[model samples]
Target: MVVDDDPEIVNLVHIYLTNDGYNVIPVYNGNEALSVISHHRVDLVILDIMMPDIDGMEVCRKIRKDNVVPIIMLSAKTEDMDKIQGLMTGADDYMIKPFNPMELLARMKSLLRRFHLFTQQDGDNSSHKDDVVQINDLKINKDYHEVTYRDSLIDLTAKEFDILYLLANHPGKVYSAEDIFNLVWNEPNPSNNTVMAHISNLREKMERAAGYKMIKTVWGVGYKIDQ
Candidate 1:
């Protein structure tokens, strides 16, 4: 799904995504996007941050409330704050306007691939090994795609869950933003702001759940779940 007030962007994205063999749904406003998402099973969403009625941020937040679908936000704003805001609202990726179609396509592919990996993990358990990770009061059940902190369920977007699992899987190992992007999205040159936003969101949710900080930010380094 592509939601943007600009028809040109929608058409451009649709063309490229379709060429890559993805079924595309284009909407010109957030409300329409919401309606479509509510009624249909959307694989992914490309949303514009600025739109008439409801806006992309609200739409992203609303979707995160119940859905773990990957969302990539498009915006004309180049400021880090704006990009971070989109990510903070639960966007899996952020792309600036006048973006290279190839780059956008790459991001879309990466997100879709990661999303499917989790979905498949939820269904396939041929290995028959219990896939669970624990850190403090937090619990991550890889096989079920479930997370809980302090015995209370914590609803995380798929990417958020993946990142947390990665950090917890290697306790005390600091993962640089670039390292995390590469590991989680399989993208080597991802933006630091994007990673920061995700880390911020993860910290907020996990900390609230455990009543203390879980992931530590290493100044001038990266993030880690200390042992």
Candidate 2:
């Protein structure tokens, strides 16, 4: 989905994406974006930050409450803090205005590849691995891409879930911020702050219902889940 108050921006994105053989859903406002999302399955989103209602940040927050759709926020705001705020609000990526359509296309493809599950091999009758990964009261079902803590649903974005699953699957194994950045993001990130921010958000969400710490910070080392 491509959302922008500017018809020109939306139409431009729609044109480029459609020509690339993508089905484009162009939305003019945030409310309509939410409405369409609730009624349909959106693979990814390109959202404008400065909307008249709800805005992209708020829309991202709302979406993160339940859905884990990949979102790339767009803005003319060229401040570093603006970009940080967008990421902290659950955006998978952000881009400044006057961005090249080709760059956007490349980013879109990257995000889609990260977010979507790989298809099973055809004609292979091999049985699937047990998809459930349960630790204490935290249950992660890989098959359904669902996580529950103490029987309550824990709504996590895709990256968050991946991080949690990675730790939970290897309890007592500590992974440094750089290690996580490379493993989870599939790229080397210069700023450890990015990893830290996601870790902070993870703790805030899961520890609320957990009543005790789940992700432990090793300070000067890394992070881990106790066995």
Clashing pairs in 1: none
State the lDDT of candidate 1 residue by residue for 197-216, as single tens digits. 89999999988888888899
The segments of candidate 2 whose C-alpha lies over 4 angstroms from its true place after superposition are 118-129
Question: Please, what is the whole-model Cα lDDT of each candidate in the order they appear?
Answer: 0.87, 0.83
Measure candidate 1: CA RMSD. Answer: 2.0
Regions of candidate 1 where Cα sits further than 4 Å from its true position: 121-130
- List all candidate RMSDs to the true structure: 2.0, 2.7
Best by TM-score: 1
- Candidate 2 versus truth, CA RMSD in Å, comes to 2.7
In the predicted model 2, the residue pairs found to clash are none
